[model samples]
Structure formats: structure tokens, C-alpha cells
Target: MHGYVHKRLASTAAKLAVAPSAAKAFPPPDAIHNPRTFEPDTYAALQPPPASSLSALAHRLGLGLILSPTEVQQACTHSSFVSFYQKHYPKEPKPASNANLASLGNSLLGLFASEYVGASYPYMPTNIMKAVVSGYVGSKTCAAIASEIGAAPLLRWHRTPPTPLSPAPLLLHDALSSISRSIIALVYQHRSLPVTRQFVHDLFLSREVDTRAMFKFRDPKKALKLLVDKFNRERPISRLLSETGRFSNSPVFVVGIYTGADQLGEGFGTSLKMAEFRAAEDALLRVFLTRTPPEQLSLPSSTFSPTQSELYKPRKRPEPEYIPGEIGMEEMLYASSGKSGYLNPTPSLRD
Candidate 1:
């Protein structure tokens, strides 16, 4: 519920068209991994995941990523003794068998759903069972079917299981669930739901997804440009990221610039800079327009900076000077404009 609310708020906020700085005032954590150096994952195994959280059901469409253990626990905790002695911690003197039985029941539901779904789809291979089971449960179809079939008998064991997880592994329902889930996973793979190259760039920019290589995008130039514009410094974007593959030699990095307009032109050394040069060589597009011709005015030096507004005040033109032999044409123009004796304003009139 919180995540969904967050997304809705974010979308509405973005449409408000506020400036970037304003949005930064209240930033939300991205879904990807954060790149910042932080503490070790000391309690990683104990952390419940987001997908399993009850709140995610309101937001996630089930087609998205799976939930973490934490999320799962938050969504559902199947403790059998809800109102029993365990509630007071002293009511039941002994441990209850109810919790174990419930867990086994859940496992059985998973297995039975897997089997029913598998039989309907003969083309699916054995490996696809897990995915199918997941789909069935996610769709809530199997739960409804199990309720109708009266699944309680399927969960009973000849002997009571010692602990919660003990009988969970041996149940027929658990096996069916695994098969159904495998099928679902298979379907997702068939639809090409794997991680993407562009996603890596989004991850890098937000610092949520970290890569060993500085320039890790499939097209390294995008990475370099981001570094150039943001970092405003030249550094090895491609070579830095490619260092990750040095030991394994995976095609984890590509070095070179783009040459063509929209397609990959050519690749050179692992340097993103050189690749950019090659791209620039292929097509150089530019636009130039000349302004109206004006007097060639002598201007201040380009590097000059004004300390105050007064420094930029425009200088007035010098008054015209007359030599002793100079002829005055003001009288003739004065007559042309039909002015009385004065051709132009006198010194007093000028003042």
C-alpha cells in the first residue's frame, strides 16, 4: 500500500512540473540497488523481502519481481495458535502442533495446484512446474479449488511433525506447488522478462544499480556523456567498467564511440572516448545563422566581469566640434524643415 501510494504521489508530483531542485527536496528511494558504500549485509538472510509483503498485493500486479522473505512474512504469518496459550506466552505450557500442520497444509496446496495445472497443459515441460504453481497461487485459483476439495485430509501425517518446517518438505502438496511455480518461471522466461541493457543505465544514473565498470551501458557513449555532462571531467568510463570482466573476460563492457546517426557505427579500442570520435567522424551536423549587419562596434574584452551594474552604463557620444573654416549647413536644413531663424537648438535650448 505504501509503495503504491508513493508511486501515485510521485506521478502526480511530476505532473505538477516543479523544478528538479524542488523534487529533490523530497526524494524517494529507487527500486534498484543503491550504489553507495554502506554497511555489510550482516542480517541479509533474516531480512524479509518486499514481494512477499502484504502491502505489495495492493500495488504489485504479480507479474513484477518476486518478493523478499520479509515481504512474504509481512503478507502472511501462518502461526496455528492465533488465540491460543501462545498469545499470552504462558497459556500453553507446551509447544503447539498447529503451526507445523498449517505450514504443511500450505505446502500441500502448492503441490496440488501444480499438478492440476500441469495436467491441463501437456506441452509444458517438467521444468515449468514451479512457474505454474506460482501462477496458480498468485491467481488464487488453487486456493479456491483446495477449499472445495476439502484439502485438510491431504495435510494429515501418520505421525505429528516435530517442528514447523519438518513435515513441510515431505508433503505431496509441497511437491505440487514446486512444479506449478516452475511452470510460471518458465512462462516469464519465454516472454523475455530478463534484465535489460538500458535498465542498467537507469540503475547507474540513480545510483541504485551499481556496476563494477564506470561505463557499463551496452552503448558506452551514453555512459560517457552522462559522466562528461555531470562529472564535467574526462575519466575512463568504458575501461573503468570493463575492469569487472578482466578476470572472467565476459563481454561486460564495450569501448568506442558512435559514428552513424542512430545506429552503432563502429567500435574501436575499449576507450569510450575513441568510439565517440569515430561516431563524430561519420556525420557532423550543425546550424548557423547571421544576425542583421550592424556597425562594427569596439566592445569590452570578452573575459571582463562587471563588479556592479553602474560599470555597464552606456557611454554618451561626444558633442560635434566645428573648425574655424568649417561651413555650417544647419541654416539650410533649418529652412528645409521651415523652422524660424534657429536651424537647431541653441546651447541654452540644448540644456
Candidate 2:
């Protein structure tokens, strides 16, 4: 029995020491099933997106230039997917994720949103302006914008393996918003600041924010009176403009807010007190929510134009200059007809 065991051990050692006489015609199959091997064509979600798919995505996003395969994939890849992939393929180099890129994009988005909001609504209160900025780049709004532009479906995210019960992880608001910002960052990198600004305006800033609805007034009448005093204006007074069904249980009262001879705002309510409150609220809204006309709107960032093309080649001629201007408080205060109404403020050029 000892002799037989020694002979068996010797045979195994000799077999291990011997090299292959010749290579096989085909590579040997993997010890474990690899998705890349089994489904090369269907491994896009797990790998970098193809240039063609990325081109389509760029076209959908109104991007004039196509991003490189690496950039688009990085923008779309969530960190969760990278972690899952790393867990599965420990030896392979970890795939690039959008963690850093997303952070950069978030800052870029905030800068653009804040500038656009500030330029458009010059008289907007600081708190209300902040909320408006949030609405432009906030997770919920970003996700919704991504969905609108068909970016949601193009996002490559899969934390869990595909199964009947739980096929993949849901694309949450944070993931979607991160991708949106990442894509914007990529646009800024590949394209120019002007292009990125235009893209931001067309996609995010164009969404109308109801500044009127965002106001919260504990005492609108008192607030209006205070605002009037702050502007060195006369005291605000609410006057009954019209009333219907005065004797009935259900009555409607139209009230107007006035300071001196100028009527600031009007509102309708069921009760006299409610009408007066609404009128004051309307007056406050008019003063605080004034916005520049779309055509007249100008952002400081508009001064920059791309000096080079997407390929980084110098332009044949200089790009057209953009004159920067903003609506100051003086402009928002007085109207063309010298009326106190807020909708259309008279333009006054400042040296």
C-alpha cells in the first residue's frame, strides 16, 4: 500500500510539471459563466455604452457634439453599479463611476441655475430665489427633466443581478439627478461654456417657476405695509373694487391694493378680510416676483463664447459678442405708463 501511494504521488507531480505540448485551436471556456462570453451583444448595461448609443443620447439631449464612449458611460454609470461589478470581478480593474463627476456637475448646475434665476428675476427675494434655484437642479426636478429628455432610460444602472422577483435596482431621484448633472459636466468638458450655458437654459432654466405660489405670508397686509414703508412709499390701503351677492351667504369681493394714486395689485375672495389679505399678498408678489422679459434677459455668463470648435480647432472668425445686462430694482419699480403695476417695468439704461 505504501509503494502504491508513492507511485501515485510521483505520477501527479510529473503531470503537473509537464507543459502543454501545443496550444488549442480555440480558447478554453471560463471556469465560471461570464456574461461577456455568453452574451457579447447584450452586455452593454454592464459595460461602457457603445459610441452609437451615446450618439443617440447626445442627439436626444440636443447636444451638437457627440461625447466619447468613456465620458457618456461615466456620466450614466451610478456608483452602485460600479460596486456590484467590483464585487463580481475582483481581479479586473474597477469600472469608472460618476461619483466625482456627479459632484462636479452638481456645482456646475447650481452655478448656472443661480445665475439664470438671479438674472431673470432681479427683484426675487433671496429665500424665494434659493427655492427657485433648487427647483432647477434639485433631485426631483432633475429626475423629471431626465425623464422628459429620455435620459432616464439611457442610464446604465443595475445593482442586483437580473431575476424575476428583483431584476434590477430602481433608478431613484438621486441617481437620476446625478446622471443629469454628470452629463452637463461632460458637456462643459467636451463642448464649451457657451454651449453648456445654452444647454442648461434650454433644459433646466426654461422650466417656469411659479414664484407667486412659493410665497408664504403670515400677515400679508402688514407685510405689504412694511414693504411700502421700506421703499419710501405711502401706506398701502385695500379698497373694495367690486362685490357680488353682498346679502347672500356666499359673496365675492374684489379688493385692490393702493398706495397714493397707483393701484399695485388686485385680488378676489369670499370675505372682505380675505379679499384685503389676498390683495396685500398680490401686491407683495408683484413687488418680489418681478422678472425681466425673456428677450431682455441677460446673464453675466453670456459674455463667454467658444473660441474653438468641438474638435478644439480655432474658429475662422471671432464669435459674436453678447452684451451683458441685468434688471435693477429701479427698473422693476416704475412702469412705462408711470403705473405702479409690476408686470412690465420700463427699461432704463445705466452707464
Task: Report the C-alpha lDDT of model 1 over 1-351, residue by residue, as the tens digit.
Answer: 445544544454433322223333233343213323221121121122232222333223232345433322322322232323243345534332234433443454444444343333332323333444544453244333332333221121122245766744344344223222322332233232222111211211122211111111233333234323332344322222232344463423333333222232333433456545434322111100111122321111211232222446753543233222211111111211222343343344223
Candidate 2 similarity to native, TM-score: 0.71
- Scanning candidate 2 in windows of ten residues, the lowest lDDT window is 18-27
Off-target runs (Cα >4 Å) in candidate 2 are 1-52, 62-65, 158-171, 308-351
Candidate 2 lDDT, 104-165, residue by residue in tens? 87888898999888887777766678888998788888888877766665565564444688
Per-candidate TM-scores read 0.18, 0.71
Worst 10 residues of 1 by lDDT: 283-292
The global C-alpha lDDT for each of the candidates, from Candidate 1 onward, is 0.31, 0.68
- Superposed by TM-score, candidate 1 places the C-alpha of residue 43 at a distance from the truth, in angstroms, of 30
